[model samples]
Target: MSPDRANPPETSLTREFLAALTTFGAMGYVVVVNPQILSVTGADRHALIVITALAAIVGSLFMGFIGRLPIALAPAMGTNTVFAMAVAGSGVSYGTALVMVLVGGIVFTLFSASRLREQVVMAFPEAIRTGLQCGLGLFIAKLGLMGGGLLTRDGHFGDLREPSVMLAGAALLATPVLLALRVPAALLLSIVAVTLIGLLVPGAHGDALTHLPAAPVQMPPWPSDYTFAFDFGSFMNHLALALPLAGYFFLGDFFSATATLIGVTRRAGLMNADGKLPNARAAYLADGLASMVGSCIGSPTIAAYVESATGVETGGRTGLTAILVAILFTFAMFFWPLIAAVPAQATTPALVMVGVMMMEGIRHLDCSKLENTVSAVLIMLLTVTTGNLVIGLAAGSFAYTLMALALRIRVAPVLLLTDLLLAVYVALSALTLHH
Candidate 1:
């Protein structure tokens, strides 16, 4: 048989449909989360839809066509909240805030285009990289908890209560049951099912669910005053805040993107004949561009999602999967109202589940190797407890570097730079609580 003939088909439409559906299922958290963000920001929902759709299209093109990786892109949850509540609330107009995001996108593009993103990723020892993924996984899970109200703010002392407990419990139960039943889009299906039952079954508690339907998709507005207007004066007002947004938001993007790429690559089993990542520059560029597009739309920054990892688990190995997912995302834009029905409780379960899956990265660490163990534990702990990726990363790198130096292991100067950045941020956050 010819070698070319032996290759599996990578462009099946039916396969792509299934792939996209699965990818959509994985993205349930974002689907549920972003609308709330837009509403809170007081931005026009229709404009947010346009921005989200464009990000998906631009991102899919970058990943599927350019990077040839099966990944989806959209607004990041953590960064969006910061932009709305913190940045927007502090006096920076939405337009000026978006400019910062665009600037961030440009930085990511330049770094990624030069493949410096790849090098920065590579500079980390394999153990640290793996741990970072695990940390992000935990971070995502924590977000599910916080968002679902499973973890709530209590006066002086905090504890999980009744409704938060109920919703969280329902979602957690629903996902595995659907998965075991071989349900397609198990994560998303479970969320909807739980939300419906919770709403109809009596005593639905905490964050009421609203029925949503598929709506027609709309085009993004021309970069304009409403969408693209950037105010130089307001930009300067938030210049200091811009650094935090740049540092934490970019790190979050990098970590999420790395985790998404690694998860999909491993599942595709498309190891380079040498067992390495493929066309990483193309992948990172797509990621950077997606963020750029998202910013232009007045939404939060975009990043690769962990839910897409579940698509990989389902035998998705081609760009068609991402393309299919993008189509679903397009359809979702219209059904924003219907899709918005999911309560945080129903969805947090899936987030927690994905987090469990991501936590597997910890197994790769060698605690017996004190440095590796310390770094891994520190990264995971700080990521979960602090709810800050960059800070956790900084602490982990700081510990890792100190260990490396003390043990007389040769370390790279790039790592030193990473540690330096992390240290400075950690110190500042500690002193000012700006983080």
Candidate 2:
């Protein structure tokens, strides 16, 4: 009998909306990044958008209705890039990459359903977890810079500000303001506010508004494009590349999702004594399904966004917020132009600010601890330098594990398992690079 068991249930509508909004944050990534992936793959952009949207809608519905969690499903950003630019880039068909994605998702789902997930969680030290979260912030902040054209490589690391300063400042200001005022739809609202400001003010480029190319990307109603084609022969040769990616992306996605959920639940005042929620499994399952379906639709795995914490902070204690988000996403498809009209400049600030905001999670971490500090520093350096989440985690985990072993530190079984998996990822990545 837990305190959560003793409490009254949240309202159904509220629950639905939270679930939908959570899903909406998950959906935003696809709208922002999938177009780029499609271009890299030689796939039709319009087909990809329609198919990806359909995939997100269907997958999100399944997670919302079937899984009964606040988790939203979508193509994951990290995995899709790896698939399109790295794995498939080496001659693997987009269809084949889709199959591998499915395979990875299946593996992740299995881990979630079984006790394996518990074991992995037990393996990492708290310091490592804190470091990873902080690293994710840096990782995302860098993305904002690249996305907003603030860090373009004119030479090295590029100029820190062009239009970036303005956009970043707006997002930075808006995020805190929205948080302080306790606004509903704070994530969406912040972006909208910044975009509005961008539109009203003369931008550095001197354009009040920028329009994305309008193309009606339609998916065939038939299932003709659904190919389960995988080159097993190529897979073996490329297993070195695929395995690390599979492990790294899976760990990063799941770890971030789990950490965010716990943080959000607590922030929403919905946590029990053990820090568990009623529909925790539902939320976790949604992440896996999002990744699985996103692959089929030519998108990356979409995980729970840290920014959605804003919704939770605003008293979104039910799933209704998530449901609202899903509905909004459905409508946004029709008004893709409006979404497109939001200049990258306007969006970058929020992302950069979000990167900064998430660093707060590290406060609970004792950086003074030797093992913790090593892992944290390693993760931060790798993240900033490589600009790769998976790489940073692998590097940090390896250092953490090696230090633990050298010091003969007795870590939890979960942490030990985490270290082992991270070791496997590091090894695989090394082999791939050597090959």
Candidate of highest TM-score: 1
**Candidate 2 local lDDT, 75-190, one digit each (tens):** 54444555555433355666656666766677777776776775676566777777767776776666666666666634245344445455655565667676567555455566
Please estimate how well model 2 matches the true structure, expressed as its whole-model Cα lDDT.
0.61
TM-score of 2: 0.74
Which lDDT values do the candidates have, in the order given?
Answer: 0.65, 0.61
What value does the lDDT take at residue 172 in candidate 1? 75
Poorest lDDT segment (10 consecutive residues) of candidate 2: 215-224
lDDT of 1 at 299: 58
Off by over 4 Å in 1: 1-11, 36-54, 68-70, 76-104, 125-132, 155-167, 180-182, 201-226, 229-241, 244-259, 262-266, 269-279, 305-318, 426-435
The weakest ten consecutive residues by lDDT in model 1 span 152-161
The positional error of residue 349 in candidate 2, measured at the CA in angstroms, is 1.3
In TM-score terms, candidate 1 sits at 0.76
The digit string of per-residue lDDT tens for model 1 on 304-325 reads 7766666776667777777777
The clash numbers for all candidates, in the given order, read: 7, 38
